[model samples]
Target chain A: MQIQTKAVNGVLTLSLDEKRLDSKLAVGFKDKVGELIASGNRLIVFNLSAVDFIDSSGIGCLVTCLKLMGPKGKITIWGLKPPVESMFKLTRMDRVFTLCSTEEQALQAVNS
Target chain B: MNQVSLTIDSRPENVPLVGACAKEIAGQSFSIDKLSEIEQALVETVNNCIEHAYCGSEDRQITIKYALSKDRLFVEITDQGKGLDPQCLKKLTAELDYNPSDIDCLPEGGFGLNVINSCMDEVNYRREDGKNHWSLTKFVVPLT
Candidate 1:
């Protein structure tokens, strides 16, 4: 799982460069985000434009990443395709994470 | 009915193979959206078996049998680990009753069965002859 990261202002954007975020990549994804949070980058935006599929484990991994960030840290996700977005909504994770339609919106939410 | 059976180690690395098999089998009859849904449901179910059924034990084996007919697609996932808990099934089925309102109260896990149930037309689980059998069926009207 290759995640591209960029820093703008104070927020770090990590773009998922994969089509599927299933069991195969969930642990790796968590570890990468965990490393980022451990390095003092708390405010984060997950750009999932390229991802079209996410299983329950993938969703669980996202929650694990959020918990790893602790209380002071913040993480938002944006650019979810319809099918992937439906998973979040169906699982009620849409309420758990700050979801945005675009990267700019996610950046704003994380910065605010 | 046309059927294909695949047996793989209970490891995360083999999940994509299962997904690919599902897509290839289901794509022969269903639409793109339905194919995606079937693949997603299969992935969730198989991943659940890997995480909970086998408990991260890669030495175990998981078998997936897919049968496609004119009106329905049937999938059976068999595992040799511990059987499914009725209580977990009850909780997962109950989750479909309402949507949570608070972000802080959102559940991080326990959504695997729900995703499977929501995607497939029929979901059944039973312990038979010391193996856990998960049966999933999706109904589709064949394109004429």
Candidate 2:
């Protein structure tokens, strides 16, 4: 799995290039998200457009990221496909995180 | 073909390797749906051994063995750590109080057993010679 991060208009956009997020990639995932939050990038956007499969471990890693960001630091997640979107809904994390339909929408929300 | 046997050493680092072997075995005979169920089951079971059986201790290795026949896929996952408690399996299988928020957020993980139970047709846990033995099976459920 590869993670690419860039700053756009003070919003950090992270694109995940991976087919699946499971146990094997969970730790590295946590580390990268932690690095982003620690770097003072409060407004974060996750681009999961490329992620096809996600399991419980993957969901756990993302939940940790959300918790670390806190209320002050906003995190918007975008581009979740069906099963991936279903997982978020199942876990009720879809409610906790500000989920956007597109990257542009997330960026717009960040700007607002 | 009678059956093919595949084995892998017990190590958290080796979980994915063993899981792949299980996936291949399951896919050999079953349809895609069964293949996915078995794969998810194996992935979760192996992850459980790696995370909880050893509790992140580097000293132990988790051994996985798979046997595939025309009728079913059988998997045995062995962990050289503290054996699993039967009560835990019962609770998880029943989905008793399995609130997602109750999940721990520590870099160390959990939930392997839950996913495994949800996916597998049958799950059995035992302890022999101080090693945790977990057997999972997903057979072709005959359509009525």
Candidate 3:
């Protein structure tokens, strides 16, 4: 559950530096991201560039983060690998969450 | 046909280890995306067994077997725990329900089996002799 955090244009961008966002680290991942959200970061760009896999639990974890962020808060997930993208598609999360293909798009999404 | 079998305690951390094994075994049989899908499906299955079947009881054992033929790969998981309810399995087989608009209405879990069902070409579940069994199959295009 290692995350590299950077701030751009007053938006927080957290890059996940892991290979899989599965059951093993789902809870910790959620809590860490939630903590950032709680600490007054309303707009977030989650970089998943290095992540190759996401299970249902991991998907659920992201959903929980969205809820934790509330209505005014937005979290954009970008840099989805092919498999990561497919999980979003299969679960139809692509419709609910803001999924971006690049860091610029992610930053733009959260900023908007 | 070639087959491999291994066992692990019903721990959440162990699921990915098994998943990685499946990916390695899949090798050139599937594309990188397909391999990732298979690994996700396998991880979902084992997570279900660890949570629903074993009730998060880390002391229990889960056995996973991988068998590969010329055209398909099969994964079977066995656990000495409670079997899934028929109603639940039916829902997972038939439904992919979720709220696409309201974040408040979204579900936090219960989509594991649905992912498995969607990723793999075939999925089956049964209970025999007090053990729960889950069988998953994926059609592969082996590389030359």
Candidate 4:
């Protein structure tokens, strides 16, 4: 699940270079997040500009990451395509995480 | 009215392929805005068929039928696996509420059926002739 990772002032930003984050990649996505958490990354940001489609399994993988982060840490997602945003709202996940528009905004959301 | 059918092995990898076909057919009948929703609904149903019905066992066949009327697109997906639980609908249709304050309370999965219901105009499930059947309907409109 080749994800692009960047560290900015202790916060890590992970970007999945995939168009569709469906069931096929769900396990790998969750595993990656688990690894990040295990590696002492508490504050994390995800850039999802390239992902235009996300199914329920994708959503579940994201929620699993959030849970892994726990209350002490923060996870912000930015660059949601229309369909992905619609899925976030449809599943009422918008209330759980701050959905940002840009990478800077997401980094700032997670950093602060 | 136009109808088309496609069959694929019960695997997670094949879900997006079927979703793409659904979007292509939906494009002719529905506006562009509804394409993702239509595809999402169909994908969820297919995933359920593979996960719950077929129990993630590959090699089994999952059949999908797409029919287009004047203003509506009907999609029916069938699988020769186990039948869906009758009590599942009540759980899937309930309000998708979560407690952000409690991380454990937040649901990590089980959004498939709920998402399908949210996207499509109608979603139904049935069992007949030793097969599990799931149907989805969407009403289309002009592009503008």
Name the TM-score of candidate 4.
Answer: 0.96
- The candidate, 1 or 3, that scores higher on DockQ is 3
lDDT of 2 by residue, B23-136 (tens): 665655676656656666676776777677777666666666777776677788787777787778764455324443432433223455666776677888888999889888
lDDT of 4 by residue, B1-144 (tens): 989999999989898888889877767677666888898888989998898988999999999999988889999999999887898987558887677667789888888888888888988888899998888999877557
Candidate 4, residue B49: lDDT: 89
lDDT pick, better of 2 and 4: 4
Q: What DockQ does each candidate score versus the true complex, computed on alpha carbons?
A: 0.55, 0.31, 0.82, 0.84
lDDT digits (tens) for residues A50-100 of candidate 2: 986667788788878767776666777899877567656544567656778
Clashing pairs in 3: none
Candidate 1 docking classification: medium
Chain A TM-score values, per prediction: 0.96, 0.91, 0.95, 0.96
Give one digit per residue, the lDDT tens place, for model 3 in A3-84.
9999767798898999888888888998898898889887888899999878888899999988998888788898998888
lDDT score of residue A36 within candidate 3: 87
lDDT of 1 by residue, B3-99 (tens): 9999999888888888789888878788877887888888888888888888889989999999988899999999999888877787546654434
Order of candidate numbers by TM-score, starting with the best: 4, 3, 1, 2
Q: Which window of ten consecutive residues has the lowest lDDT sum in model 1 chain A?
A: A65-74
